[model samples]
Target: MTSFKIPSAPRSIQKDNPIKFLLDSETIDCLAHNIALVHPVFDAQAFKRLALTNIAPLGIMDRSAHIAAALKATLPAKFSEAADILLQTLTPPNVHTDRLGLSVFFYLPHTRFIADYGRDAQHNSGEDPFDVAMRAQYELTRRFTAEFSIRPFLTHDFERTLNQLQQWLNDPDPHVRRLCSEGSRPRLPWGARIPQLIADPSPVLPILEALKNDPSLYVRRSVANHLGDIAKDHSTLAFEVCERWLTDADKDLKWVIRHAVRHPAKQGNATALAIRKAAGGR
Candidate 1:
């Protein structure tokens, strides 16, 4: 476990919770090894003792929350310092590697650490904790998606969050760009729904539009799914957006438009089918 590597395949399962093993004793030991490598102050024994305590009854997210709590309890009380330690502990960003599988969940506790503590101003002692939070998430997304961790930030600051996400559309990493769209998704599965986005998805449309033809399908697919979420609530707007993109759509853009309208097309919605036909998704 000194090597601090995640198994390519899950080591075990409890009721098919593939992520359950992330909280296992071995993983905790390895995580401690990795964290201790970079953070001189991290108390490995204390972290392991706390992380493993009362973990058996929990499911995946609960496990993540539990581990995050342990980190906060053991790491520095100063938010900025603790965030830096965790950020420094990250593995290299996993770019250009699709279907990275469950192993990336190795960072699940890292993301949970931010989500649980990202907005703590008292601990920040006058520093804007949000800025550091955003930085941590940016780094986290490249290695392990920050989509779920970002929701608390969106809830805490809608305009600021959207503005930051908007700015990330042009990021060099496809993972970061994909997060711009995926993180704001109205009904992103497993992610807490952003009520503002769900109530009126207009704010997120610009992000989708910007990434509609992203060079990485990893990013384009997120844009399409975000569009599909918009369609679930704002069908007309989604349809209009798809139609506009189709005006001179290249194959990539066409693929995006087609994916966005797939459900409606399946149900024989005329406009959806027409758009699908134009995109040549058949």
Candidate 2:
């Protein structure tokens, strides 16, 4: 298998710089406050203490996990009930993709909360936990990404998750549509790896196809990256998919195919290069 390297972010942090900590103490406390408002029984101070304890030493992702753990500790023991509380506490949904600023990061713990506790949660309402999780992701994704939260469902229940993602392909929210592709990426950076998808990407090909001509560049970009991930392990398959798309491709789709083969084109893969050239890439 060929290698594809993703550059890591700078780990050195200026502890005193407030911007360095996106989910710092104040943010965690704010998260607690929001949950407390929706949930009458929640102890906001206890949640704040648990979420903030030793959080100063952690990175942004770790802080998300830490706070999610605190949520597990203090929230209702039943994952379904806790998920409902978190869902109720969400702020307004976002429509545009950029300029949202770091405030969007506030929901990181919310997404993490679903991922950690909702993976196998059982319910009495005859509603599958998958339904709750996907609904939460649909809503959570509107405000902040649920890409990270959607993976466990993908792994825990592949066919069911894929079906739900397909149903969401036409969702009005671009963020929700983006999740259909980005969440299923075989080699999603800084997210859980789907070894099965990594080994055989045929399953997600339909997803890539459905979103190939998406109106939002945000969604199309994820399709390109999803195809790019497929290229890493299945070069011929990736090139073939791009080649098929190029036959009657539009400007937007042409760009997606070009980007899909970018890394392999750099690595001198003949098929990738040919696909790139055909897609009008320099």
Candidate 3:
């Protein structure tokens, strides 16, 4: 696994940039260590041995604000370039496989980075003569989908970046196909809570439906999550989706139910609790 190293942003491009203030390796290590203490026996070395980062001990809640701050600070001067570096850096060497916690930490930040960069490129002068926003989105997504299989993080901007990602999704890349599902999730853990998707989720329905029987297991997991998010706000819709999915008796769908319902169930939502009881789910 390669060590992820984003090129350091120079001061000239964006002076007194917040990003420059936040890209501190000492800070990241300190935060990572602090969170790692949550699990007494969690060994950081062994966890990083398998070409990934560990999420069990550190969940997203503790680190999200810090990571978001770091990434946000970077946007003014090096957004486009910094985004490229961050995505490249999040791969195996830079992170562990326990992606749920990791996604919460990085995905939301990444999405915001993309959005901020788009805004910056659109507004900033001397960026590029040829539509920097379009180019930046294109380059960012193109490189991102290649290394990471997480779509939920990448596709939070379907309306803005869909044109950029559509070709890749339609391409031979299975990763991109997986992304189509992962990126549209409504309640994707630490990822942005897509309010529209949580309420309606219709915008991404076609994408998930197309991926219901995807060849890749990785891709299929996203379909289940997309459906599960719907279950959070619209139980009726989730029930319908589960009804269809249960016909196939997929263990993965069960996993989605358990994960997606955990929060609502804990909150004592009557509908979720009833569904859990009826399904004999704990």
Candidate 4:
């Protein structure tokens, strides 16, 4: 297995000037205020107190982890109960909306909590936990993204998770379609690496094929990234997919193929170079 370098940001916080923390005071306040409005029983004051306690010492990722831990401690004990509250409180997605809203980004911590804490319960239950997580992720991505949260299921049950993701390619929501590719990336940034997919990317090819020419550029970009991740480990496979997609390609797909082959092209791989050449690259 190639030991791909993990980004330095996750290892240590920057020294002189700090990166902005996602779960800062204002973001927490916005999150609490929104949760309070939707879930009447939610204890906003208590939640805020728990969330902000000792938060200054933590960096960006740590803050997100801390917020998830706080939600587990403060929210309803039952996984479904807590997840339901989050699902009900999410802001609806709009077609014109390209970026996540403030409240939605803040609420991502809660979604992470559900995905992590609720994993065992959903797996053990008679019902499919991936489905449960997928539903929560679908709603969550509309506002923010469940891309990070959904990786656990992929690790836990690859076949079932990938199957569901394939179905998601046809979803009405572009976010959900994007999740199909983004969540399944072999080397998703800030996400736990899926060694199985990295070793054998055949599983992910179908999902990418389904999303290759998706109407949404958001989904197309994710598909490109997912392919690029594959190229890191399996250049031959990535080039094959790129070659297939490039035959009589439209403008959008040409962009995806070009992005997918970038890493390999950089390495001077002949097939990758040829694909780039066919795409009219200089």
Candidate 5:
């Protein structure tokens, strides 16, 4: 079987500005076109105007924030109504097999908007909006990703949110399975740190156990990253997990274990060193 390599972000995007790549005029036009297909009542021109207004002065993060706020303001006032509109507008999952395809970039802002709205509502209402948020995230991830979006739930309601993530372990879609680990990482980049997990990552062991040998490399990579996050604060725990999983492991599983202990291995931690030795320093 031949694998298709997904191209990296354009050099212009990488060197100039990531925000421009995401919210550029071309992306907005694609978004408008797709949205109009699902929503006859949608005002594409108005939506574009709102999203692009004053967007020039902002930096990368601020641009994303501005777009989220703009989405909420222009779309239906009702949360459910607005969420439904966005969900319907999502491009088909099969349309973009490449993880970093243009379609994913186009949908990124919309996913973030859903996440921000859900998080605010959950925080203010003091209610677990896990179901609603998870459902939206599950769908949104198929198009782009909800990794950063799901962090609020994990922060506010760790146990409940974790239980929901555990259920996602069996999801047929590799993205959903990946989310189980990625969304729960203690130190995910560009995401809020989860103090509880950083202090004691034992709660997430079950999740890691389930995905340690995931068929999808995408999912397995997340498991490794989640473990690496754990190692930052709990090196012993990370080392122990790696040691246990290293014995009689295959190449793929060993890759995961190595990634899990990368930080500790660099620092000459005994157990990390031993695990690397066991894997023959591959």
Candidate 6:
């Protein structure tokens, strides 16, 4: 990891500072509040000390709860410029997945810009350390779903996203594969619930189907989670799909079943649970 010098004032923060100026916007305030909440979870002083020394992305994540709101309010006026700024500010040395997770909102309103950045990152030369660029792509998709309702432009990329996900499922890198599922998941924590996938997740079904038996526990966990998201809206359909593969399912599949079925079972939604149980145990 290169030495990251945190920008004096992140560009996103500068461009969208007007929102900050106005009434102390709810989103910005929320980020401030969340940071305070996270302070106790991890010892702030120790974490900052570690950041000064080791300089890991995790350190940024520890502080991101505070940065999210500022990022959210700071959207750039132009797409190209925004992408350039985000890539410069958030990449390498400063590559903090958790923090980026929060700051990701900075790009939420302009997903196309973020997508372009992802494409550039994929082709650009550098260490590509920690697969940070790939993770940004994932976060971009995740936020796209969460912040904005599914629109035509977003749906247009649905197929491509699924294709990329499928390709990554077989990636030699387990983390990349995990990101594939995580990105596509309907209910990935803090990610958007892809209504298109939820209404008819057929696009991603085949991909998850292929990954149900993935070797990596990390990747398999994401597979289970992706299915679990589908199960939320299309319980019968998701259950049926899972059952069809029951005979082929391995230990990982079982775990997926448990994770994917939790909400339905907890809600006492017999219809969904019955299908889940018939497919397999808990």
Best by TM-score: 1
Winning model by lDDT:
1
| Higher-lDDT candidate of 1 and 3 | 1
Model 6 clash pairs are: 61-99, 145-192, 146-192
- Which residue pairs in candidate 5 have backbone atoms (N, alpha carbon, C) closer than 3 angstroms, thus clashing? none
User: What is candidate 3's lDDT per residue for 1-98, written digit by digit as tens?
Assistant: 32333333342335544332332443344323433444333343432332122322433333333454444443335455544444444433212222
Cα deviation of 50, candidate 4, in Å = 1.8
- lDDT score for candidate 2 against the true structure: 0.84
Q: Name the candidate, 3 or 4, with the larger lDDT value.
A: 4
Candidate 1 vs candidate 3: the TM-score winner is 1
Candidates' RMSD to native: 2.4, 7.5, 12.7, 7.7, 5.0, 12.5
What ranking of all candidate models by TM-score puts the best one first? 1, 2, 5, 4, 6, 3
Expressed as tens digits, the lDDT of each residue in 1-282 for candidate 5 is 222122234523455455455566666666666666766677878878887888877664566667778667667666666777777766466433344545355666776776678755543255544576678888987767778878878887778788888988999888888888998898999877888888788998999999998998888999998998888888878888888888789999988887778778888888887787786674
Model 4 over residues 1-282: C-alpha lDDT tens digits?
222111112223446746546467776776666666666677878888888999998876678777777767667776766777767656556564453333345656866775687667643344445556667777877766778888888888778778888877888988888888999898999888888888888988888998998998888999999999999888878888888888889988998888888887888888888898887675
lDDT of 6 by residue, 1-282 (tens): 333222122334455353222222332333323333433232334333332332223222222332332332343333333334444433232222233323444333233334333333233343221234334454444332212212222345565545555666666655455566666676656444567766777777777777777877766777777787787778777777766766756666776776777777789977657656765665
User: Which of the two, 2 or 6, has more lDDT?
Assistant: 2
lDDT of 2 by residue, 1-282 (tens): 222111122234345765437787767767776776777689988988888889887877788899899998998877788888888777678868876766677788889988877766453244457777778899998987988889988888899999999999998888999999999999999899998899899999998999999999999999999999999999889988998999989889999999999999999888888888888887
> What residue runs in model 4 are displaced by over 4 Å at the alpha carbon?
1-20, 97-104, 122-130
The estimated TM-scores of all candidates read 0.92, 0.90, 0.49, 0.86, 0.86, 0.51
How far off is residue 178 in model 1, in Å? 0.7
**lDDT at position 105, candidate 4:** 50
User: Which residues of candidate 2, in runs, are more than 4 Å off?
Assistant: 1-20, 122-128
Candidate 5 error regions (>4 Å) = 1-13, 17-19, 94-99, 120-129
Give a tens-digit lDDT track for model 1, residues 1-282.
344455354534447555676667876877787788887668999999999999998988899899989988988888889899888777788956475766788788889989888886887776779999999999999998999999988987889988999889899899999999989998999888888888888887788878887899989999999999888888899999999999989999998999999998898889899999999977
**What are the runs in model 1 whose C-alpha is more than 4 Å off?**
1-17
Residue 237 of model 2 has an lDDT of 94
